[model samples]
Target: MAGSAEGFKEFATSCSGRLFRTAWLLTGDWHLAEDLVQETLGKVYRAWTKRSRPDDPVAYARTTLVRTFITHRRRRGSAERPSDALPDLPAGETDVALRVTLIDTLARLDAKDRAVLVLRYWEDRSVDETAAELGLSAGAVRSRSFRALDRLRAVLGTDGLTPTTQNEVS
Candidate 1:
């Protein structure tokens, strides 16, 4: 038990930042990203305590975070309306305008489209891996990736984010 806790602590300490980054992309808000990471780690910790931790904990965590994000999106009530105007950001955020623009554009995307884009482009995940994570066939992942990028291009006015290739993200 002691060893298990220590191992879990070590894994969490090392992976939390990466997890947070993925969560941040999945959710376009810092606070929400933090909450998502917390929830993901909670799930990982439960698995760890069971001594049934995955052989690849990193992959497991990533899958868990993605699944949790989509699940929450599905379950969340539509009572909360998104505001067009972004809140005033705190100091010291690099590339504020760029980040805000990208996040804002991403926020406009459908949940599944956003997930596909984040996994395929942001995470640099392969088609098969993304397919497994999102529970789609490889062909489906490819189709969705293409459509999602097109949707993103449409939303960004076709001039803002035109990647050279389907896999490339600008």
Candidate 2:
């Protein structure tokens, strides 16, 4: 009741930013990322009463956000059309050029490839853990991880958009 509500509030407050970062990487669009985070939080809240809350609600929320992004991408309107002009980066965002390059590269990737990369590298998740989250075999995760990185390297090199240091961006 009240206790459950309070716990959820705290969890959401602490985890929402992390979840939104994952969502943004998944979506490549801020508005869609916000929607995905809200949807994930709603799902977590709905399940809170039926089962004990996850030991790591942040992990739980991330899984939900990834799955929700996957589902959304399957829908009819989810295919994005390329735009000529880049959207303005959020104010005070650091590493503007690097972030823009990463987001652009990520957007070019297939949804599953992007998901595998984000989970494995961006989140620094283990192969087995990412496999479990995406319901793939560990071998599959490994293969995808290799291919995704190779693609990024190829693209960055050809475009001359390589960052000095590759940081695991949110």
Candidate 3:
């Protein structure tokens, strides 16, 4: 029992930051992200003791976070209304401006679509891995990815980075 608890702690300590980042990106709010991370870790800790092999703990944690976010969004209504306008970027700054634009654009996306973008681009997960993590089929993942990218391009303007029709995000 003690050994299992210790093992769980070790895993949590190592993966918590990455998990939190994923949660933050999913929720678009720091406080909500923290709560989601806590909930995910609690569930992971509970499962850690009973699992046989516990391979790919990161993947397990990520799947838990995604499911938790999806459930919460469903219960609270699908659309999230931002109370304030997006923050403005300083003039003549390209990187920061682009990042701010991207964040604002991402905030506008549907929860599941945003999850697909984060998993595919930020986490650099392959289609198969993303599909498995979200319990989606490969074709579904591809379609969702395409749609998300298209939405992003529309939001960011066609002048910004546009996803290729060949299924590659630019």
Candidate 4:
């Protein structure tokens, strides 16, 4: 088995990008995203050094990310207020409009709802996996998923998901 320190360094270097993206989606703030990833990686490294290392480090790290996000949201004075100003995206990014709209809609949801959407659709995890990660029952995961999708559709409106030109419609 690889030394825990070496293994963690390798894992963090290789997986940081994807983990950052997930954290960004969960936190809805670039700064918070970076902080979340750092905190999660620290937790993952500590767990990796333990006697019983997780069989799947990536999955464990992902779970840690979600759990950390949830815990952070639950702490006093941690609730974030929505800002009127939008952050600038990088140049030459594809589908900027759509991305902004989706992020805006996601920002409207509470932390747990946002987490459910990201984990289920973005991470492509099963109901059971999401349930376990969020510390909810499978039934609760399904109910939350349904409610989250409905909220998204309601908020997105016709202009958000629909094509402007009829010819583009499938």
Candidate 5:
């Protein structure tokens, strides 16, 4: 029991930042990302003893994070309207504006589609791995990837965003 507890602590320390970054990209809110990361770590810790390998702890944690995000979105119901109020932005000009805009566009997508994008592009997971992680078939992943890319292109438009590869879309 003590050994498992120590192992979980080490895993948490090592994977928390990467997990938080992924969560941030998914949610677009730092506080929400922190909360999601904390919840995911707690769940991972609970399963630590049962987990077989230490080397892929990050993968385990990431899968947990994605599942948690999906579950949370489902519970919230995608139909709930976002509030009109916007948070104040900092006064500095930045090169990441387009990236932030892209993220905002991603937020407009369905939770599963957003997860597909993150797993495929940000995490650079192969279609097979993403399908396994999401409990989806490879064909489903490919279909969703195509639809999601089309939606992103429609929402963000083709001008400002660089053209996505056909392979990426398909």
Candidate 6:
């Protein structure tokens, strides 16, 4: 698969789950996350056919996912709604409550802030990488990251997911 020019199916198959997790973090809606993943894959597939392969396809997919999510958020009709859609958990999982609270807090954030936080923290990208993906200055990304974390701390502080637990999740 490594040498195949038609390797996008393999690439997409391997990376789509990771892409969907980031998308879900960004959008906080199951259906929207799936749509965002499909769109990111479509873009990657086009690039895979028409251009040279990315040196780092995982990074490329994550950038595409973040940009697509921000683009979708810019549309007037693309507002996120909580769905009954929940990720399937393993049996006897006790951490669902914290996860739910965290996602709900994330969903309350502004779109760009949420993007910044997801890329910088959840994906563990460097400041420069996150700024590049979101098309922001390094200073801007830094500012947003600080403020977004503050917002998360504020909301999650009162929502039973404290700073320590949140840090662990991060």
Best by TM-score: 4
Q: Write the per-residue lDDT of candidate 6 for residues 39-69, one digit (tens) a residue.
A: 9998877777754667888898899999999
Q: Write the per-residue lDDT of candidate 4 for residues 60-153, one digit (tens) a residue.
A: 9999999999998999978867799998975553565666767788899989888887888767799899999999899988898889877877
Minimal lDDT window, size 10, model 3: 161-170
- What lDDT score is found at residue 121 in candidate 6? 74
Ranking by TM-score: 4, 1, 2, 6, 3, 5
lDDT string, candidate 1, 52-151, tens digits: 5587889999999999888878875723757899988855434446556767888888887788888888888999998899888999888888887787
TM-scores for every candidate against the unseen true structure? 0.45, 0.45, 0.44, 0.46, 0.42, 0.44
Estimate the lDDT of model 1: 0.80
Which structure is stronger by lDDT: 1 or 2? 2
Q: RMSD of candidate 4 to the true fold?
A: 19.9
Flag regions of model 6 displaced more than 4 Å: 1-5, 80-170
Q: Name the candidate, 3 or 5, with the larger lDDT value.
A: 3
Candidate 1 wrongly placed segments (more than 4 Å): 1-3, 78-170
Better of 1 and 4 by lDDT: 4
Colliding pairs, model 2: none
lDDT of candidate model 4 versus the reference:
0.82
lDDT of 2 by residue, 1-95 (tens): 22288888998898899898888887789999999999999998877755666766777878888899999999998887778999997555467
Query: 68-100, model 5: which lDDT tens digit per residue?
Result: 988888885744657899879966544466677
How good is model 5 by TM-score?
A: 0.42
lDDT minimum window of 10 residues, candidate 6: 158-167
Please say which candidate is ahead in TM-score: 1 or 4.
4
lDDT for model 5, on a 0 to 1 scale? 0.80
Clashes of 5: 0
Residue 71 lDDT, candidate 5, scale 0-100: 87
lDDT of each: 0.80, 0.82, 0.82, 0.82, 0.80, 0.82
Q: Is candidate 3 or candidate 4 better by TM-score?
A: 4
